[model samples]
Target: MSPRFQCKQRGAIGLMAVGVLAVVLAFTLLVVDTGRLYLEKRKLQGVADTAALEAVSRNGTCLAGLSAATYAGQSVARNHFVVGNGNTLVTQCGAVTTAASGQRTFSANPALSSAIQVVASKTVTTSVAGGIWSLFSGNSVSLNTVLTATAVAAKPTPTLAQLSIKSTLASVDTANASLLNGLFSGFLGGNVSLTVAGWNGLLNTNISLLSYLDQLAINLGVSAGNYTQLLSTNVTASQLVQAAITVLTANGATADVLTALGNLKVAAISQAPLTLGKILQLQTGTTAAALNANLQVFQLIQGVVQLSSNQSAASATLPVSVLGLANITTQIKVIEPPQLSAIGDPALAVANPLGPNAIYVRTAQVRTQVTVSLPVLNSLSGLTTAVNNLVGPLTPVLSGLLSLNLVTTINSTLCLLGAGCQQLDLLVLPGNLPLNIVLDAGGASSYVTAYSCPTGSAGTKSVTAHTTTSLASLNVGNITHAFSSTQPMSVAPMPLVDLGIQTCHKILGIGSCDPRVPFGAGGIAIQVQSNIAGSNSIQDLVFSSTTPFATPPNVGLASTYQAAAPATNLVSGLSTALNGVSITAYQPSGGNPLGALAPTVVALLGSVSAIVTPVVDNLLAPLLNPILNNLLNMLGISLANVNVGANLTCGQTGEAYLVI
Candidate 1:
């Protein structure tokens, strides 16, 4: 080749060689640099994970939050490559700390951010082909080459979330529901909860169950706010109901107990859980539970109340007058102490003394000793003075729940207010009262009149009570025979069993017109014959007196009640009411009153309205207003709707009230 042309060709060859060298160098560097970067990243990431897990395990609550951030930083920086180059580069990194949130969001701190990072420097060197070729042109053996490389290693935003935040919320919702169901079942005496298994142990591993229970009672007022939110959890209606029941039971609320129960039943009936098995299980369980669990599905009660519409029952716009507010379902201890605001009418013992009741002075400074042998109470009553408080609506249907054995265990004295009495049927024979009483005075067991029944007229009997008493010996004999001449048994089934009117024979539970006892929308005409001169005793009874079942032709409403009134002895007034179907008298058997019904006084009271006050004339006492009483009784209404001074005082001494 020519010298000049040869030189140009050689230059081209060398240029091509240099380009190839550059290409190979770039490929090699790419592998080494990327690999180094990856390794460094892994190291930093592992550090973050370690520290974060430590903090989490420790539950750094004060900074359960702040520790998360610290952990992330610590993890990201734990490993590093200080490139011999004074320059240090960290691109991205991240770390996790907390387990979960109220929303079930579990992740390390800055969940999506890089927690650590590091970078390396760069350098380049010439290739063998370039150095050799340059040796021939100049005295130089090789040529210098420069290359730059930069490495960026960092944890990137998480493509995968450790935990979904929404999941946390879902979990909380579930847990809360379980807590609720568990509490409710426990309160109502149901089987121990499967969820709150150990909770049934009746002992808080952390504290005494009683202490917890007491604390719950105290904090209930405050915790109500926390619990109220639980009610609004985004769950099905049935689930919500279950939670509500649990919370209320755990809290031991008095007023809201029934209300919560009723609500649960209602939710069960309406929007049941979507889970079919759960729904069926709940239904069956509730059915079984209600047999023993009387926490009262207040929700169902509300439903029943809701059943009332703008309609009339026999022309009377129905006012939902539940007999009592407090019921027997709750234990008596759960009955909050009475406040004066609870007092109302019917303060006397008569006219259904158990209801429309009033509190009278029992033997204060009383000894707790029951018999000389066994005492009913543990400690003596230091009742030198009492702070009278009236309260109650807890009636038999809900309150006085009998034990499975049909036995009632009571260590405390029963105290009720006038409002309580208004709900009780006192005039009923034997009364709606679930107790027996015995009065004592005048050196003998006496039946002193505490007060006459509001709805009933007072009847007199010739009672001869002895006044002489002995200290060593208690004169506890029949005191009725002292007043007039021959005392006869006073309380019979008529005014005692139920406050109503009936035919003389019907009240006596025999020889009545209807061959069978009748109930529901029926009437009776009771009678009394003052056969006191020779007759000895008279009695009456009150029963369901249900009407006889019959075919369509015989289907009719019958006042399913039977009552009677009879008199003898020094009885005063005698008359019939219910258009002359029933009778009333003052005395039992024996003596007779000296005069007719009191006229002047009767004129003032205006026709005596189902009741006749005797003119000092004891005979007329029995025969007062019979018709008006039956009419009132027929209505199945009480004097509560109207305003009146109703006072019913029940006094029981030894042998005061005897049930045969």
Candidate 2:
């Protein structure tokens, strides 16, 4: 029993040990293969993630020269991932689109480079369990498995962009300086006195936009680096001027500029509060560094003052003397304030430039009414004498046209006593008359329409914008109603001269009579209305640097806009109006004094035209042209021309991250 039992037990023990050893060996092989596969997958995933991030951060594009795949391959090589021979790395350029429900999807586009996607795969030996099964099955089977990883990354939406709108008044001479002083002084509701040199200094000075915003934030007690809040804050004109002073002083502005700014600041003390956002538009998510552009001091100050005036209740009044023969008074009201500059993300603007959130800028809309008082009409005696001489010779013709014997009427009235009577004297124009001219300038506007970032070192960066110059209207006539800011002026023919009869009594060669009176039926009036057409066009504002926001340049491209043919010429307008002179007739309170002469009076208009035209031209050529032109030039309101400036900052590099 001992020998047989011992032998059987030993054999059973050896068999059990063999089976246990086989199970342990299989389990160990499974564990080792699993670990190997996991490590390979982890390495592949790392390569894909890093490659995607690197490609996006490098600003790689799918455009012609530098492609996203090229950048991703370099990154994979740097990460020690070999491609080819059963190991593959695929890169794609695309964009990540967000749906209304906030779901995101990646769309591959060879033309788009907003995002980068990478797929990395490696072929390795199959798991130990599969090889063991294949050996037992006695049939040749595949022994390799593929592991793949995918990753997508992109930079944040909305690269930075900037735009500026400039005034056409580039320089200031003595005449312009005086006009500026009067205009700004009236806008501020205070006296602004600056020398020509001081005005020119202000015009030539440049202020850093960043520094100005920084100083403004400090002045308003806003936290640093909060440009968005700073721009939207409402600050008085005095505060804006003070911030400009601080920035200019820090930037070493000239003494004359400083003095001029000081004077302006004092004048702006009583001005109302205005939002800087109204004048300078900054889009959401704009970084402080993106605002590193420059602005002309004069432009800044002018924008602020105009904005303040637009919100106020008072209108600016400027008194001017034209040709020393007429005293002209101009009342200017800003219907809408100007958008002097703007900075933003071009992506949003490209979608819809005229949309509510678009980065659009426009010049100011102004209504200027010029009232001319001819207190010195007596000084235009030459014109009056010419008109009298011309009409005196036509008195006989006028008798036939007027259906009345003017010579006989004068004799019957003044020679009642049978004494010699003086001839009938006709005065062309009265001693004093008031004339009014109104001009409505609906300034120009510009907005971003498209943009592109640099794809390579030699790639050009640019921003395209659509510009529209608005139409301007000029009215030269008599306005019976008060001027309105929102409504168009109702212009009627201005009474230039009144054709009437003068009665006198002569006694012993002495004359005693009633003064000449206006005709009860007929008078002369001048009416002129002209519309200056504008233009619409597209412009490209190029950027010199790839990363403009990093350190913005001081200046940018400037575009000048001009109206269509027959630019704004006040004298020309008046002259054209004079050519179209109208004769009006009205009945007296009782009845028509001329009875049947009304028709004849209207017929006399044709003959009077020839005489009135030359006299009016003679008066206007010498008295109105030079003065009106000088006044309009000083106001910087050319119905014909405008200027706009633009700057662009695509975005900064090295800001890419995993988005999906």
Candidate 3:
């Protein structure tokens, strides 16, 4: 090549190299700055994400009570990225927004507190890019680029479960039409005049929690997701009646049930949604809500009727007549609160803020009374006369007689512990007739606690209870019987008896008779008594559950259960003071006196040995003992057959949920 051309070519090559270098520098600055932006953006995103999550977790619900959530969020963001600490800068500190439907929105409204959103920005300075730009332009443009990152997070709203009863009216006592009618009327808002068949219809229907909730949602014309709206809706009395009719109609209830529901009254103008807590409170005569307002009025009415039916079945009245000598009747009742009768409280499984060691349970109480009436011994005197005629002048004891009656009432309270409850499932609470009983008699009482354990066999459990009662002073009042005015007599004291004496005496031209002593007696009264209090037990109160345990989102199978100690000493220090009992002469204070009669009278008086023998052994003992034993037995109730209903894990109140 020529030297001149080669020099020109070299200069051109140098110029091309300079141009290429300039392009490379521009590309390098762009790439470096872009990379810095990305890294800073990622860091800011991390800060926002951490802050948002922490904030939401701290304040699941946006409320004034949990104002610390904002502080926690800002602290977390500052820790991750803060101005003067690095390239990080939180342009908007403590800024929270709700993100839903792929959009982040902010408003000064309380309803949008479902989500927490954090926005963070960072400024990344570039030295190399600025220097390179300055070299070419002889001035530097702003190389600090601001990058922002945002994050949204929220927790899901917690759900609660209302109990669903799966029981039949067969467990209820329908024998007493009055009791059944009254209970039905009270719960149904008026007298529906339910017949046995109608009661059967109500009792046979067992509803599932989910199905009921769905039906309620449908009736409310809302989706299941709109639980808050459903809960907030006011339910009128007419609406409640209509809802029941709708549910029953949908479930193919009997005609009688439909008619009965149709007949319900619309007295309550408007009411809030029924809740389990409210049901329990109502049973206890209170109108307070115990659980979340997740149930409608129809559901509450259904629960009320179910429990009332069961209780009705548990109560009974029977008429008893003992050979016309005594007529007695008995009334028995089993009482249980509706809520505790169905599903136990979840709070009970953990702890009762009200008190410690307060064993919560689904309970049933038993109360029974026996009314006894006995006429005066006037009728019983016939037996004495008959016996005297058969024994030829061996007249049985006789004494003062009058009308007598008695009222014996016994009350018992029992509870079923450790019940299984599930959310959104049918709950068939065990029909343990009676588990543990607290027996109260007069002023004395005893408590019996039952221990039940699940057996190895599926769906089987056992219960055993023990208690002792030693009543010393049981005030069984004095009894009296009347005889004819001319021939008054009593089996309680001794009548005249002959001692094989050939010498007979006649008084006032009457028939001859040997002297007989009357034992001291008004009536036989047991002042103080002591006996062993026996134990009562029932086995295999088997309860089969299709939905006993629960999974996540619902509280799992509860490991915590309440247990209590039974009363060991039932009735101690019983002091009895029996009255109207003594052996005395039945003859008048003054009578015919003679030298031979004196010895005979003394000998007859010595016959106090046989005084109580015939009177007690033949008449009173046989009739009275059995009655007393039966009365005692009626005071005790044994429970078996336990069933578990639906379970509910009501999350803490004011729990927030993610809406985005």
Among these predictions, the greatest TM-score belongs to 2
| Positional deviation of residue 497's Cα in model 2 after best superposition, in angstroms | 3.9
In candidate 1, stretches whose alpha carbon ends up further than 4 angstroms from where it belongs are: 1-7, 26-36, 59-660
Once superposed on the true structure, which residue ranges of model 3 sit more than 4 Å away at CA? 1-37, 53-61, 76-184, 187-189, 192-359, 366-395, 399-638, 644-660
Best model number under lDDT? 2
Q: What's the number of clashes in each of the models?
A: 124, 0, 43
Q: If the candidates were sorted by their TM-score against the true structure, best first, what order would they fall in?
A: 2, 3, 1
Residue 308 error, candidate 1, Å: 24
- Candidate 2 clashing pairs, residues 3+ apart or interchain: none
lDDT of 2 by residue, 1-660 (tens): 699999999999999999999999978888998899999999889999999998888877765566678889999999888898799988888777677799888887544566788999999998777777888999676789889999999886546666666666767777677777888888888789999999889778888887788789888987655677887888999899999999889878899999998999888855477889888887776644456577888888888888877888777887564223335576777778888787777888888787755878777877777676665444555655544553454345435533333234322342323433323333345435566766666766778787777666666566665666544565666764434545665787666555554556666688776665565434556665665332223344443345344222322223223222224454455566546544444322135333344555466666666756675556445543443355444444444455545565556555788877
Span of 10 residues, lowest total lDDT, candidate 3: 421-430
- Candidate 1 residue 573 Cα shift, in angstroms, is 46
| Higher-lDDT candidate of 1 and 2 | 2
Model 1 scores a TM of: 0.21
How much does each candidate deviate from the true structure in C-alpha RMSD?
31.8, 15.4, 19.5
Q: How far off is residue 529 in model 2, in Å?
A: 1.9
